[model samples]
Target: MTIHLSKSRLKYLSRLGLFLFLLILSGLFYASCNTQSSRNQSGKAHLGESPMTDSMVVDQLIQRSRSFYEETGMRAEPFDRFLQEAMEIASRHNLLWQQVRILNTIGRRYRDRSAYGEALRYHNRALTIAQNINNKGLLSEVYNQIGVVFRRTDDNAIALDMHFKALRLAEETRDSFNISVAINSIGNVNANLGRYHSAIEYFLRALEYADRLDNTLGKAINNHNIGECRLKMGYPEEALEYFQKSLAYNNQIGSRAGQSICYNSIGAVYIAKDDPVTALEYLERALNINDRLGDLMQVSISHSKIGEVYLLLGDFAKADDHLNKSYELAKNIGSRFQAEESLRLLSRLHEANHNYATSLEYFKTATAYRDSILNEKNINHLTTMEAMLETEAQRNRIYQLNQMTSEQLITLGRQRLMLTIIIIIFVILAVITTLLIYQHRLRIKYNNLKNQHKLLRSQMNPHFIFNALSAIQVYVLEHDVEKSTKFLTDFAKLMRLVLKTSHHDFIPLKDESEILKYYLELQKLRFVSPFNYQITIDEGLDQENTFVPPMLTQPFVENAVEHGVRLMENQGHLDIRFKKLNTQMVVEVEDNGIGISSSIDQKQKSGINKKHESMAIKITKERLDVIRNDIGGKVSLEIIDKKNINPFDRGTLIRIILPIVSQNN
Candidate 1:
């Protein structure tokens, strides 16, 4: 196998062999480089497809990311990578809407992971881009995502504001998906605020919209929210049903995170149902899923649930371990609510274990956290309430100013019209003397009618104001600040409504009903004697779209409350009814109190409330007259003393007929 040679000849052969080997090595390297270049060229060719094919690729990537999101309920590794690739392609192609969409997806992922700062940063960037592109749909979605971030961070006020803003944008664009999302977000905020009824209402509405769109994710979330609301409302059985429904939907979509949430919710319901064994089963399932998904916030919540189940089973050691783990995880994620719950459970566990000192320490910490949370919630509520009150006050002031300005403009317009008419009459006086005379008569009649109308409205203003002030003074004299504050708020609202509609000839029947209800409530508050009232509208009548003269029946109602029911020995009852009868609107105001005749006699003899009685009658007559002339239709008011029909029935009844006016008219 070996060949020997002389030294010189062997050296020459070794040199020659080394040279050949170096040549072969260089050739092999060159071939390998050529093969790699060809492969690179092939890959480049595959990537640089037709424009249509590139667009398809981007769309496919985006769709894949969305599918992954639906499957995982948050961003899985594949989902993130897919979105990244799509983002790169979208950015390079200047596909702005797609870019914004991808950014929103990423923001939601960060939000789901409890990375609020990163979530907000991404959402804000997407918002900027969406606004620059004037993409309302994208803008709405980004706003929604940002709202979720704020909600997760417990900035409920800001979160609610953002959700409302998103709702407005979504509604404007008619983006059904975004609309449902925004509504669901708002429901979550309300739930956090402990407005479970309002939250349920919002969730139901969102669910309806989602059902119409067949959106599985939306359905799953809404169902979960409804379950939480029901659970809070003390309906464990109902809550369990909703939670199971949510789980079904989540399963249908293969949403692991959603399934985890449902498992936790179901566990809560089972605990409420006093089935600790079943609860433990669900809690463990939720914890396993949360741990695998790396959802620290959810993990904390799940552990706390498991701890609660263990505590219910009297397993102190297990409870302590789980609760401590929950507390640590909650602290890591900055979830004060979860941390507080865990601490509270820990305190209970320690107390059960007879560790009095440790129990007290944990109890103190839990109490501190609870108080802090309550303080934040109260501050938020009070701030929102004050702002709303201020806004209403400002609106009233602005409306009053506008009303004054409008009246001045109307007076100026009337003067200009009168001057023009005078000029025209003078110019054609000789040529059309008879016509001018007839026109002059018409003008005089119109002016007299207008004066009567203004006089009737003015009469209502002072009488109502004086009575309201007198009632308010009673509360003030009693030094009842709470009652006085409440009375003042109601008075302000009524005054604002009256002032707003004072100048209008007609307003919606719905608005009139609201005013009547408010006035009745205010009157009831003033009187020591209690009264009951019911307002019924015919189902056939369109209260919102039907129009009638403003405050047409208000004077009669006032008379019933003030004269008939004010000093009644027994509790008085009032019934008001609105009906659509053929071409006319019929209203009935009946009161079970002193007869009108008796009331009139009492007031006349005492000389008290005489002026109010006269003004009421005067305004009623004048209003009827104006309405009859203006509409050129049948209008009548009839007052009946119930004693006249039957002496035992001591009450007053009034019926009125008005020409129907549609909203458009």
Candidate 2:
């Protein structure tokens, strides 16, 4: 080793050593490359028989699972199995995108089953993968899915935050579909929080995006959401229109679940309109669809709505049956909200049937369910806060790792502070607007009450009293003691009846009939001409049960007796009839005397003042308008001149139609 060598031999040996080291290095590099290639190929092989086949297989699996979930609803076992297999395939292949999809599917399945904890776990995993891959599209979908889970769990604040994140990412990525989905989800959260106008605005934006994308499902869902918001806001007519549009879209898309929802919503609108028969028909159709689809949740809702319809129709047995079925189905499905609704309806049904004890039990159960809902909301709030704290911790850790400058950090803090200030301002404005609306409604109510009182006073006409007193004075001057006594007694009774009835807004039909009888008798005695009168009442009317505004028919009767009968040369006849027509009471006052036109013409020729009669008619019309507003029904008057039809038949027929209301109503 220490032998001396020539300079050329030493240089050749050094070069040979360098060549051997280079060869060793090259050999090691090739070995590492081969090992990595083998590992990647093996991972790909584990996913399927071949790389090409793996993609097809995974796609087919995803499509099949999605179809099954859509057709049925949250069949957890099958869905979980499919999702697990897809996840394993994705993991083995190291497919980050595929893993995100699989994890999101798992999260959705868990959410559908109401397992919020498990749902959050998988959604968080998907979010991690999306962040690692730095895929904005994938991140948007993950955020949206998480938002939907949070919304379902009643964590509205977190849900709204996630939806806003998703919307931002979707817009950045130019993902139209995900943007629409995010907007719709936000709308749903707003609706759940009872911010109907905000919900509607979001839904409309979603609808616009959905229409641009030609997404039939998105369009239908957005329409349905708008309908729900409108319904909640007490716009049943507008809600019904939206629901019909949704139904048409659902039908076009062949979406049975959407169709069922639309039908249920339409039925609810009809129920609000008090058209129970039509509501029943729509609800039954929805029930049939839900039954066929095996959608227990929708079935439960349909049963509850049908029960409401039956209750309205006074079919107690049917109402009891449907409500019990609704309760059982809702219980089976673990839908506490639907269960609470069913219980409330059952309580109302039992109360309607006069079972106070049973109704109280149901009411207590409903209250307990309501309390449980509130507790669940509180729990959701705690969970959302925990999630937010965790997210903040992660952000802090991320910020520490980031190479952002101090100026950038300060700017971000300023931006956050500004955002907070803006939100506070918005909330304050919303509160102010709500207060203003409430104050306006109070003012309108006060004005209505004041007008009602004024109308009541105006209804007590002075001309009739003066004329009656003048007629009584004539009898007193004639010294007819017996006739004067009989006339005075009838007149006193009539005056007392008018005074009593004028004090109240509504009187029983029987009481009004008695008042009218006394009034006509007084008029007959006061008049010198021979006058005959008949009163007919429909057998179908329950006079004691039906109520009408006091003094409704008196003005018309006074006009017939004073103007028509008084001017007649021959024997005057008056016919008064009360008949019940569906929900309305029809009062007909027919006088075989001078028509209204002839009476007016005669008054004009005699230079007589008929201003009081015209004023009374106007007041009666105004009173009817007020009564119609109070009772939520129509009150109309029609005048028919018999002389117009036949010259020989000189008379006026007045018909007053009024809504029949119950005392409790």
- Best candidate per lDDT, number? 2
Per-residue lDDT tens digits for candidate 1, residues 1-665, read: 01111332335545655565566556756865897799787654433333666577788998888877756653265338898898888767667776777777777776665555666666777776776556788888888887887786678898999999999999999999889989999999999999999999999999999999999988888998999999999999999999999999999999989999999889888888899999999989999998888777889998898988999899888888899999998787667778899999999899988999999999999998889777755654454445445545755776799899999989987997687567545544443454445556655665675566555543455756687788888889999888888878887777677777776777888988988888887777777877999999988888888887777788888888877877689999999999888888899999988887788789789987655645556766766775665565779889999999997888999999988888665
Lowest summed lDDT across 10 adjacent residues in model 2 is found at 1-10
Q: Model 2 compared with the native: what TM-score?
A: 0.52
Q: How accurate locally is residue 20 in candidate 1, as Cα lDDT from 0 to 100? A: 56
- Candidate 1 Cα misplacement greater than 4 A, ranges: 1-88, 288-300, 325-340, 360-665
Model 2: lDDT of residue 529? 82
Please write out the lDDT profile of model 2 over residues 1-665, one tens digit for every residue: 11112232335445655565566556656865897799887755543334656666677788887887777675446345667777777677666777788888877877776666667777887887688567899999999998888888777887999999999999998999999999999999999999999999999999999999999898898998999889989999999989998999999999988888888889889989989899899999999999998989989999999998999999989999999999999888888889999999999998988999999999999999999988876776566557656766876776666646666867986996587568656655565565556556655754675466446543445776787778888888999888788878987787687777665667788888887888888788777786999989998887887777677787788889888888777889999999989988889999988897888788888998766356556767766665665555668998899999898888999988888777655
Instruction: Give per-model CA RMSD.
Output: 45.9, 45.9
Which ranges of candidate 2 are over 4 A from the true structure? 1-50, 68-75, 380-665
